[model samples]
Target: MSAPGAGPALVLASSSPRRRELLARIDVAPARVASPDIDETPLPGELPRDYALRLAEQKARAIVRGEGELVLAGDTCVAPGRRILQQASDADMNRRFLELLSGRRHRVYSAVSLIDADGVQRSKCSENIVKFKPLHADEIAAYVASGEGLGKAGGYAIQGRAEALILWMSGSHSAIMGLPLYETRLLLKQAGYPIG
Candidate 1:
């Protein structure tokens, strides 16, 4: 493992390929990639924004030993009103999530947190509005059968096959993918990481 402050090495606390790809886009090459296992059950009356931030912080803290390494973590949630729509683990759940988001505008919240070697934690939240086209029964079934939404939030991947269903999107594309590049860059810079 790379030592802390060894040319700004980062430890990414997530297993999401999308997030990993997003980090790569910003030229961040993590020295260690650790996925934090935590209870993601939302608390009673927890708003989506609060839930996202809490999860992000928890993830970063879970993987840290207070050694002062730069730890990065993030969480993304799809919310229609106060309801949070998470990744569908099965076909039925994907179908129901798609039915609910079809032809409607929903909010995507992504929270990013960074814990520096000094144990100082900083977090930022990014929100985006996405409008999806009405989906036909066949389209939904086909998409579900393709299994692309199996592990994606809101039962779709904005950067994958589901891109066809998006009518409009307002905000950073990287936010929808689970990391906001501008915000992430800011956090990394604050943590003393050099970004070209």
Candidate 2:
């Protein structure tokens, strides 16, 4: 069936502006953007990759849509070792997270899920390694004070002031910012979302 009503032609089950911007890069505009309400907390002992994929798929299926409509969702996670660093909610947590990541490489996993009209689901995950320069106490303090990392995973926003601290990286930049464009575009196109 054709896109339902006058929506963009797809449904984006996320509220992240970054995800929306990433989608625009591939020319896939959602017919309706519904921020899926779901528990984002990781299950006990869940690995970062598993958590990210579960969240992405859960978000996609959580959104209410017609049988003929399609929904897309995504999740990004920062993991140092097997530990998943959650979104920093305060300056203290930001400081602690940054200190842990001061001069080490961490994994950033981004997972995308697509649910088609017939309820078929497809997903892909992109993993990247990001290394940050050893940060001085003052530097971490200042970054925390800036508050850019407060709402970000692993207590940092790679797209903001935190970029200056990145020493090297290998992986999708878009994935670190919360969405993996290459994987996302491929998924959307394969699902017939009219994306480039």
Candidate 3:
């Protein structure tokens, strides 16, 4: 295993453009990107926080790698109460998600996992609370038609048109967007990546 701060090579095990953009914010680019194919279905009775962590770690583990490569992966889950919401795959699902968020507060759990060159792994989770405005039927319908909610956890993209409907949010915006910058940087730094 590379010693702490030994600057091992880095690989990203995710296909998320948002994560790419966020990594650039810290001026650390991965040497390569790998798309790990894995089933993301929530386990029966699995809580959102645990699911997020498991997915992140599994993605990192799923990546095929060479020696001296550190693989990074992340997952984000939206949970209201104990119910974990699925990505809105259709307009109907989007509408239903919006209805669930209307005048309500929910938690977003974002987890980042890193598998170091020596196969040692570490992970961290960012938890945030997001509140939405009481959405009316017309706006919900219009937003659902916009299609921004599709494939997004909680059926809304805060960086897109959904911003207008947010009442308040307390958490890492990067995490909500898909990856947590603060935690990601910390993990990388400890794993020996110079975030210059």
Candidate 3 lDDT, 1-196, residue by residue in tens: 3234447778899998888888888887787899999999999999999999999999999998789989999999899998999688999999999999899999999999999888899999999999999999999999999889999999999899998999999999999999999999899888877774
**Which segments of model 2 are wrong by more than 4 Å?**
1-8
lDDT of 2 by residue, 89-186 (tens): 99999999999999999999999999987788999999999999999999999999998998788999889999999999999999999989998878
* Each prediction's TM-score versus the true structure: 0.95, 0.93, 0.94
Candidate 1: which pairs clash? 68-117
lDDT of each: 0.88, 0.89, 0.91
Better of 2 and 3 by TM-score: 3
Query: Model 1, 29-136: lDDT tens per residue?
Result: 788899899999899999998999999999998995535468999999999889998888899999999999999999999999999867889999999999999999
Candidate order, TM-score descending: 1, 3, 2
**Model 3 alpha-carbon miss at residue 140, Å:** 0.9
- Model 3 lDDT, residue 50, Cα: 97
